[model samples]
Target: MRKKIQIVRHVVQLIFFILLVLVVVGTVCSFQIGGFQFTEPLGAIQVLMGGSIFFTPEKLYILLATSAILVTVTVLIGRAWCAWACPVMTFNEFIEYIMKRLRYKPVAERGKKKIELGEVRFATLAGVVAAAGISKTPAWCNVCPIGAICRTRSSGLLVAGAEMLILGVVFSANMYEKRFFCKYLCPVGGLLILLGKISSLIIPRASEKCTGCKACEYICPEGIPLFRNPDMSKCTKCLVCYSNCPYGAVKIDVI
Candidate 1:
């Protein structure tokens, strides 16, 4: 029964990943065919910061309010977006799939050992701060491929640049490690880590059942060792650990 559940979850994750890629491709094609102008929606924060004002103040206010609500929810729900929603992450997984099929595993069983807070994370934050200080708009969001891809149908040049940049980085990372983007870059993942600390939902360990076989650790895509810290910041809460656990030791709960 447990194996069946794991298989189903894996299949669902793969399907969602494929759908996200299709959405990006279709949106870009539609824009090319329709000749629509790319208009970005403005948030209150963006307006206050003196960034590009694509939308009215009223709309920006609404956007800000919506962002606040979403951030609040994220603080309570772990990085659900990373696990089940983010198209970039989904595409990353698809890339992993390609590597796997070719028997060229991008991730290793031993897991990549590294500290949670490192120079890369600090540099990323510093860049965000500099951008925010200089411009009303957050530079991180401007460079986000997810937003770029979603708007590809309208903003051909911008989308092309974004895709080219992301693909270059992704390919380079794959040449080194499986998910270097999620590990060292990704401003969104950084924000999600901050939210994850207060998340209502978490992956917990069943100490009684765990035999310390480390199967879950070996299979974890994020390099999280469940035995060390079940609530590691990098965990996407995809439930892959729970599904792969030979002892069924990992579980999810509202904390």
Candidate 2:
């Protein structure tokens, strides 16, 4: 059985994000659709690239403030932003759930030989920054899924098509690699992962009670080896390990 706390927390997060989307994009919100200031971390990247081309000074200040808050929170709670907030993560989890229901032989299956894609996130982060600097515009903004989600439907076929293409690529890749986009591409998630390294939060293993069942290891979407400690930064704090441990051997602590 699934854990109630994580499920409830996730549902609440989804509801809050949907309401934000309703206000921002009317009926067109999604992973590549509607969003809010607190929903995505792209605005901060835009600010650091230069000033906001679209936001007024007041709004820019709010965006920066919220981004700081997000980073601070992540530093305190590990990468819980992905677990508890990100729309991309939320949708990916849904896609993963559906894939499971359909019994798709998920590529990230337990004991599978995993594709090792290290440093890609850092590279993409650098690429986005450089592209934005060279273009003197938020280069990725036009195609940012959160911005697209928050855009008006009148943007016509080009925007919609781009969003669909991006979504298709990411979702299709998910079939072969669970959360492939977040793991390998998303710059914002990369930033959060960087911040999470400084966070004291962690899912501690009660080695004494673990009994080597490996249930936690099997349930991890990130394929983290949770029998001991997971690959710290790779653990997104989903707490699936906590819930799946029949012996209740996984415990979270702020260290």
Candidate 3:
């Protein structure tokens, strides 16, 4: 079942990535289905923060309506966007695969001290919001890799070049760590983390049948200890532990 889930997730990621490219080419508007818009929640927040300096209520209502789907999805699935749908994650995986082929091990696999960047992520979120309000612009979006990809064909060469440079730097950082951007730097992911805390999504969790083997932690991309007091905030709902568990200790709580 876990194998099947992973397969489906990869397919979904690929589909979304393709749709994102289509969006870049002006083939589609927002992620819309059945006449409803699905947009990035962080984008809406940034717009609200930037425009609120002048008290833009019209934009507020429009943003709220557009962002509703994304916000609800985050609350239901705990960053499934990051793991299962985001084009950024798909591209990161490609980089990771190339790095592995070149024998560059990730920090987690190196037995080195992993730097905690959760605080940095939150600080970035605050900084970007502050910058947006003061500048009356969605400041971070200008440098955001996701935004970069979406605007690549639509924006000027210099603008797109700068955006891809930021994306390249972020992706290259993964040579030292798996998912460096998603784990530590994405303000969008930071916002989703808060929403994901209230997620009702049934995920692979350590059951009473678990031992103290710590196998799940060793395999977890985020290094969360499933049999221990794991930080669910960092969980991307990847379920790698569920598939790799030797004792079948990780099971989804259907209730």
lDDT digits (tens) for residues 113-229 of candidate 1: 634545375477556656776875665566656555555444564557766686667666764666667767766666667767776566555456777787776677666778765
* Candidate 2 global CA lDDT score: 0.68
Ranking by lDDT: 3, 2, 1
Off by over 4 Å in 1: 1-48, 51-57, 107-119, 155-162
Give the best candidate by lDDT.
3
lDDT, model 1, position 109: 26
| lDDT (Cα atoms) of all candidates against the true structure | 0.60, 0.68, 0.75
Range of the 10 consecutive residues with the lowest summed lDDT in candidate 1: 28-37
Please give the distance, in angstroms, between residue 228's alpha carbon in candidate 1 and its true position after superposition.
2.7
Worst 10 residues of 3 by lDDT: 22-31
Candidate 3: how many backbone clashes? 0
| 132: Cα error in model 3, Å | 1.3
The superposed Cα distance between candidate 2 and the true structure at residue 235, in angstroms, equals 2.7
lDDT of 3 by residue, 99-187 (tens): 87998897756888876654577888888889888887878877887777666666654567776788778877887788788767888
Instruction: Tell me the spans in candidate 2 whose CA falls farther than 4 Å from its real position.
Output: 24-40, 51-63, 108-114, 150-159, 201-204
User: Model 2: C-alpha RMSD to truth?
Assistant: 4.5
